[model samples]
Target: MRTILQRVQHASVTVEGEISGKINHGILALVGFEPEDTNEDFEWITKKIIQLRIFNDENHVMNLDIQQTEGEILVVSQFTLHAATKKGNRPSYIKASKPDLANEQYEKFLQILENNFKAVQKGIFGADMKVELLNDGPVTIFIDSKNKE
Candidate 1:
C-alpha cells in the first residue's frame, strides 16, 4: 500500500459534478494498493496515518496528531500511485493491484479509518473524481507500507 498524505485546511471530492466526500482541517489521503499488499499493510499504514504528528501545536511545532486535534480524514483510492515509469514516458500500472482486489482493500482501509478516528470521509472507488483542497502548510508526506520508510 502507498499513500500520499496532505494536511489540508479543507478538501472535497466531486464525481460528475456532485460532491462525494469532503473534510475540513484534516488530512487528504490518496491511497493505492499494490499486488503484494496484505492486511498487515492496511493495519500499519492506517495506524501511521492517524498517528502522524503533522499538525502544529501552540508553539508552532508539529506536535499534534489528527486524533488530538479532532481533525477529519478524506481518503481516495488512486491506483496510479503505483505507476511504473522507468522505461518510457507513458506509465505502467502493472504493479498496482487488480481492480476487484484493490476495491476490496480500499473499502477495508476506509473501515479501519472510520473505526479508529472521527469524521472519516472517502471518495467512491473506481470513480472519475475531481478533488480540491486548500493545503495547510503545504505539507505533504508519502508513505509506502511495503518499505516501512
Candidate 2:
C-alpha cells in the first residue's frame, strides 16, 4: 500500500461533471494498492494517516493530528502512484494491483478511514475523477506501508 497525502483546506472530487465527495480542513489521500498488499498494511497505513501531525496548533506548530482536530478526509483510488518509468518514456503500472483486487482494497481502505475520521469522502474506485483542492501549506507526504522502517 502506498499513499500520497496532501493537507488541504478544502477538497472535492467530480465524476462526469457531477460532484461525488467533498471535504473541508483535512487531508486528500491518493491511495495505491499493490499486488503484495494485505490487511496488515491497510491497518498500518490507516493508523498512520489519522494520527499524522500535519495540522498546526495555536503556536503555529504542526502538532495536531487529524483526529485531534476533527478533520475530514477525501480519499481517491490512485494506481498511478505505483507507476514505473525506469524502462522507457511511458510508465508501466505492473506493480499496481488488478482492478478486482484494487477495488477490494480500496473499499477496505475507505472503511478504515471512515471509521477513524469525523467525516470521510471518496471518489469512485475506477472512474475518471477531477479533484480540486486548496492545498494548505502545499504539504504533501508519501507513505509506503511496505517500507515501514
Candidate 3:
C-alpha cells in the first residue's frame, strides 16, 4: 500500500454535480493498494495517519495530532498512485491491484480509519470524481508500506 497525505483546510468530492463527501480542517489521503498489501499494511498506515503530529498546538507548533484538533478525514481511492513510470513516456499501472482486490482493500482501509477518527469522508471508488481542497500549510507526506527506513 502507498499513501499521499495532505493537510487541508477544506476538501470535498463531487460526482455528477452532487457532493458525496466533504470535510474541513483535516487531512486528505490518496491511497493505493498493491497485490501484496494485507491487513497489517492497513493497520500500520491508519495508525500513523491518526497519530501524525502535523496540526498546530497551543503554541502554534506542529505538535498536535488530528484527534487533538478534532479534525475530519477524506480518503480517496487512487490506484494511479501505484503507476510505474520508469520506462518510456507512458506510465504503467501494473503494480496497482486489480479493481476487485483494490476496492476491497480500499474499503477496509476506510473502515479502519473511521474507527479512530471523529468524521471520515470518502470518494466513490472507480468513479470519475472532482476533488477540491484548500491545502493547509501545504504539508504533504508520502508513505509506502514496503519502504521502511
Candidate 4:
C-alpha cells in the first residue's frame, strides 16, 4: 500500500462536472495498492495517517494530528502512485494492483478510515476525477507500507 498525504485548507473532487466529495482543514490522500497488499498494511497505514503530527499547535509547531485539529479527510484512488519509470519514456503500472483488486482494497481502506476516524470523504473508485485543493503549508508526505520509510 502507498499513499501521498497533502495537508490542505480545503479539498474537493469532481466527477463529470459533479462534486463527489469535499473536505476542509485536513489531508488529501492519494492512495494506491499492490496485489500483495494486505489488511495488515491497511491497518498500519490508517494508524500512521491519522496519528501523524502534521498539523500545527498553539505554539506554531507541527505537533497536532488531524483529529486534534478537528479536520476531515478526502481520499482518492490513485493507481498511478505505483508507476514504474525505470524502463522507457512511458511509465508502467505493472507494480499497481489490477482494478478489480485495487477497487476492493480501496473500499476496504475507506471502511477502515470511516470506522477509525471522523468526517471522511471519498472519490469514486474508478471514475475520472478532478481534484482541487488549497495546500496548507504545501506539506506533502509519502508513505509506503512496504518500505516503512
Candidate 5:
C-alpha cells in the first residue's frame, strides 16, 4: 500500500459533474493498493494516519492529530501511486492491484478509517474524479507500507 497525505483547509471530489465527497480542514488521503497488500497493511496505515501529529497546537507547535483539531478526511483511490516509470516516458501500473481486488481493498481501507476516525469521506472507486483542495501549511506526507516509512 502507498499513500500520500495532504493537510488541507478544504477538499472535494466531483464525479460526473456532481460533488461526491467534500471536507473542510482535514487530510486529503490519496491511497493506492498493490497486488500483495493485506489487511494488516491497511490497519497499519490507518493507525498511522489517524495518529500523525501534523496539525499545530495552541503554542504553535505541530503537535495535534486530526481528531484533536476536529479535522475530517477525504480519501481518493489512485492506482497511479504505484506506477513504475523507470523504463521510459510511459509509466506502467504493473505493481498496482487489479481493479476488482483493489476495489475490495479500497473498501476495507475506508471501513477501517470510518471506524477509527471522525468524519471520513471517499471518492468513488474506478471513477473519473475531479479533486480540488486548498492545501493547509502545504504540508504533505508520503507513506509506503512496504518501506514502513
Candidate 6:
C-alpha cells in the first residue's frame, strides 16, 4: 500500500460534474494498493496517516496530528501510484492490484478511517475524478506500507 498525503486547507473531488467528497483544513490522501497488500498494510497506513504530525501547533511548529486539530481527510483511489516506468516510455501498472482487489481494499481502508476519525471523506473507486485542493504549507508526505524500514 502507498499513499501520498497532502496537507490542505481545503479539498474536494468531483465526478461527472457532481461533487462526491470534500474537506476543510485537512489532508488529501491519494491512496494506492499493490497485489500483495493485506489488512495489515491497511491498518499500518491508516494509523500513520491519522497520527502524522504535519499540521502546525501554536508555536508554529509542526507538532499536531489531524485528530488534535479536529481536521478531516479526503481519500482518493489512485492505482497509478504503483506505476512501473523503468523500462520504457510508457508506465506499466503490473504492480498494482486488480480492480476487484483494489476496490475491496479501498473500501476497507475508508471504513477504517471513518471508524477512527470523525470526518472522513472519500472518492468513488474506479471513477474518473477531479480533485481540487488548497495545499496548506504545500506539505506532502509519501508512505509505503511495504517499505517500513
Error of 6 at 94 (Å): 0.3
Flag regions of model 4 displaced more than 4 Å: none
- RMSD of candidate 4 to the true fold? 0.6
Q: lDDT by residue for model 5 over 1-149, one digit each (tens)?
A: 99999999999999999999999998999999998899899999999899999999999889999989999999999999999999999999999999999999999999888989969999999999999999988899999999985
TM-score of 6: 0.98
> Among these predicted structures, which one has the highest TM-score?
4
What are the clash counts of all predictions, listed in order?
A: 0, 0, 0, 0, 0, 0
Residue pairs whose backbone atoms clash in candidate 4: none
lDDT (tens digit, per residue) of candidate 4 on 19-107: 99999899999999999999899999999889999999999899999999999999999999999999889999999999999999999
Candidate 1 stretches greater than 4 Å from native: none
**Distance (Å) between predicted and true CA of 99, model 2?**
0.6
lDDT scores for all predictions? 0.93, 0.92, 0.92, 0.96, 0.95, 0.94
Candidate 1 lDDT, tens digit per residue, 1-149? Answer: 99999999999999999999999999999999987887889889989999999999999999999999999999999999999999989999999999999999998888877777879888989999999999999899999987887
Cα error, candidate 2, residue 10 (Å)? 0.4
Pairs with steric clashes in candidate 2? none
lDDT by residue (1-149, candidate 3, tens digit) is 99999999999999999998999999999999999999899999999899999999888899999988999999999999999999999989999999999999999988888777758999999999999999998799999989953
lDDT of 6: 0.94
* Of candidates 4 and 1, the better by lDDT: 4
The per-residue C-alpha lDDT of model 5 at residue 115 equals 89
Per-residue C-alpha lDDT of model 2 across residues 21-137, encoded as one tens digit per residue: 999999999999998998888889999899999999999899999988889899999999999999989999999999999999998877776676658889998999999999999
lDDT of 1: 0.93
lDDT of 3 at 105: 96
Q: What is the lDDT of candidate 3?
A: 0.92
Q: Each model's TM-score, in the order given?
A: 0.98, 0.97, 0.97, 0.98, 0.98, 0.98
What is the Cα-based TM-score of model 2?
A: 0.97
